[model samples]
Target: MITVVGTGTGAPLSPDAGAALAGAGLVVGGRRHLAAATTMPDTAERVVLGPLAPALDAIEQYLEKPADQGRVVVLASGDPGFFGIVRALAERFGADRLAVHPGVSSVATAFARLGLTWDDAVVVSAHGRALRTAVNVCRAHPKVAVLTGPGSGPAELGAALRSSGRVLVVASALGAGADSGTGSGASTGTGTGTAPDSGSASQSGERVERVTPAEAAARDWGPAVSVVLCLDESRVLSPVRTIAGPPPGPAQWALDEGEFTHRDSMITKFEVRALALARLGPRLGEHVWDIGAGSGSVAVECARLGAAVTAVEKTLDGVERVRANAAAHGVDVTAVHGAAPTVLSDLPDPDAVFIGGGGRELPAIVTACARRARRSVVVAMAALDRVPAVRDALVAAGLDCDGVLLQSSRLAPLPGDVTRLAATNPVFLLWGVRPPARDEGVAQ
Candidate 1:
């Protein structure tokens, strides 16, 4: 039988897990993972898995030789089922061929130490890649915990967040050096509080505290073992009971033109913006580009609705305003300082695109939007002359184009104890969607 064990750094072997590893004759794992299997009989062969490709090749070679030669033990960190080596091994050898064991995950211990609930937390890893992906999530999600690695460790994440005017909490070495070590090999990403600190973030911090990687390894963290980051630390409202999850209240999107802090007459009218946003349909798991985002009301609103949003605002003033608005609403929106259609090249392909400030560039911007957007594009225009040209651009891109003339009036109290129709302004909304390929259409 093949047994998998989690060798949590600072904690003792769990009863069941110890039993499994004790019976193994051959053990393979990362250098750190091998610690738990070290106490096995001297006759057992110990192998270190690394550089992944070579390690996997060696395992396959051994499995091909014989089964009864010896029982094999594979060691993993944290919950092996999660982004762990178990994925690689299971894929090659098949699930039925293995008997698994588990431990607590980093996310759980981190949150537990902070006395926070992780059900709503967005957990991501920046172990080997650039920290951009995790940074983006922190920009967007209120409660996020990022698993850090060598390059993208605590300090890097902290610096990125500090520059963005966001506050964060970092925990390191959660299962190591702590009396309550991390649980990594578990099947689930949760942990039960067995000691006094169990289950409550309040008490958990006492048993397993949070620290930066530097602090944990610095001889100062006492017994802390891992990092748990809170993106918006300044806003953690002390009697912080509720999740404050998914924004504090209702959405007040599509605000009037005058609502934004813009100087040079660059605002999308309320009516037109409403139509543009409807066609765009922003939400979580998708990306939207608010090109020429003036005050960033649309981009901010989309982010609050859970979409990963990027706002390309050319002017420094507009970028600042967008940042302020995004923070005020408690949503993460990236207000990039650049011109778009030109600047759009580096970003991930957008699911939706909105052009509110692009003038004669509307057509080209629309074309670019069509190419980059997987679903739809929406453009706003005040000049009647630009409408047809923009519409034609959409049609030429092979999209079903549609346009709307938006004229809205707010009821105002008149001086003579009466109500009046306060006509705001006239604007146009142009939306388009690409027709599915004829040959590749879904078969009925």
Candidate 2:
């Protein structure tokens, strides 16, 4: 049977795990883990994991040996089941053929070192994956724990959060060199309790430091980092959560225009926003850009729907309005005080984009957004003259273009006490979705 053991930080193996290791014919782990395993049987075959395929092959081959002879033990960091190696092992060898011995996860150890409870915090992993979504989560949530990897570690995360008013509690190398016999990993300089030391900011040893986003962005944090906790002290202990992690999406969207603070009726109406949001399909773990955000109503609504949102507006007043709207709704939106088509170059490519106001540069903005959007782009225009050009821009970018005209009427009471239908100005809504890529010469 294959046994998976969690070596939690630097904690020593438990008695049962130790017995398992003693009887193991094959032991597989990282170089650090293998080096720390002094109790492993001298005759045990060792496999240092670099590329996982070879070790998986060894496990499969050894499992095929005579019954009761091949005892394979795999050592993993923290809890193996928590975004760890357990999933891979379970998929390969049936769950029935394996036993799991879990230790504390790195997230748990990091939080413990900080003396904080994380039920209200959102936990995301940047290990071998994109850091954009993690950065977005930090923007939207008050407390976030990011599991760091080689390229997406603290320095990268800190730079992204710069000037965002969030503080980063960087925990590095938790339990790096501490003797497992004492049941404590390395000591974080703070003597708060029994929690092990998360590593130092320097690559040489273990340490923990809490710094503002701007401060974190300016420093050089070594590569030995483990996890970084992004927090907004103002909301640290949020209203006691009945459920864990980020709260559920807002009960309803397409809120009325009166909900936001706008100047000169610059916000998109609820009627149009509903349709545009439907086409955009904002949801968790996705990024949406609202170019030419007037009151940022669309961006705020998207953020409320659980997508990471960036609102780009040129005017200083418009930028302030967007920030205010996002704050009123209690969601995070990165409001850029710059014009689109020029500012769009530095922002990460979006999953979806909504162009609400771009004046004469509408076509260029639509082209830029459509080319980079992974899913769809939606544009709202009041000027009839711009419709054909916007549609053509999306079409030329290889998107399937669609459009509709929306005209709504509200019942208003006249002076005579009779109701009349007051028609609102008509607007043309245009949207496009990139068609799936096809092989050469394939039929449409």
Candidate 3:
């Protein structure tokens, strides 16, 4: 049978945990982990982990031994399940063949030290090829704790967040490496995993508390926490988990302007937006750029269809409002916090582009959209004089161009006794499509 042992807090071996090492005929673990089990009666034959491949081979060799011949104990740090080697071991051997004795996981200890409730936090590892998933989760959630390895450690994460104006608290090396005011931004005492309650260290003493991302980055932080401070709070993804999703309901959207909190003269009218969404035809596996995404109605609708979208607008209030709208719709649209044509550089390329507002930059933005868009570009113009220029820009970029003037009449009360048709201003929707050369020639 395979017995898993957790070296309690990585300091002293508990009486019960120490006893696990006494009669074992085989012990498997990292060199340092097994070495921490010094209290064993020295009757155990040790198997050291070198390069990963060799370690797996050693574990397989130990499994070949006859049952009841001798006991085997595998040493793991913290809980063996939280980003540990236990999963691989279980996959290799059936669950019935092993018994696990866990140590306090680093995450539990980290939370305990912080004295913060992490029931709503997601635990992820940045030890792989990319930190993007962890970063994305951080952007989507209120709280997250990332386990670090080489390359994509705290510094790397901090550098990536520097773009989105995010703040990070890098707590490195917990337990032993927590000393010297390094990773955690404070020097911690050698005591075990529980919090000291003061929330911070005074002078030379160590404890748990909040520290600035800059302060955390300046030190040689230990294996610790990467606390992400959002560009804004709404970016947080709720930390609740469920076995399944809720039941579906009618997709009642394309709401009127009165539903949201928007600035005067800043909302997209539903009629115009419906046409834009119909033309955009958002779907999964596609990316769209919604320029001048006021109220973010188009972005939200497209994202609701599962297409990844990015909204670009000028005013900070407009940008934040767009983000709030997108979040309310439960769609993933990166609400860019700056003006388009300038802020569009950092974004990923798009498959489709939509322009809602502009001045002289309108034609240039349209041209850029045409060149960048793999399929199509859509522009909504408010002025009649600007249409010729926008249409010319699209056709100049070699796209098939079309335009429609949309004028809607709202029903409003003309007198206390009767209602009349109140016609609103006209809007020009000029669309451009880059059809395949074969199809383009077919029209001839």
Best by TM-score: 2
Off by over 4 Å in 1: 61-68, 128-130, 149-162, 168-172, 177-230, 237-288, 292-295, 308-329, 334-352, 360-377, 387-444
Encode model 2's per-residue lDDT on 258-349: one tens digit a residue.
99999888789989999999999998778899999999999999999888899999999889999998999988899998987999999978
Question: What lDDT is obtained when candidate 1 is compared to the true structure?
Answer: 0.68
Structural RMSD, model 1: 8.9
Best lDDT goes to which candidate?
A: 2
Q: What is each predicted model's overall lDDT from 0 to 1?
A: 0.68, 0.84, 0.65
lDDT, candidate 2, equals: 0.84
Model 1 per-residue lDDT tens digits across residues 141-173 = 767777766667656665555545554454444
Comparing 2 with 3 on TM-score, the higher-scoring candidate is 2
> How much does candidate 1 score in TM-score?
0.64
Where's the lowest-lDDT run of ten residues in candidate 2?
190-199
lDDT of 3 at 91: 83
By lDDT, rank the candidates, best first. Answer: 2, 1, 3
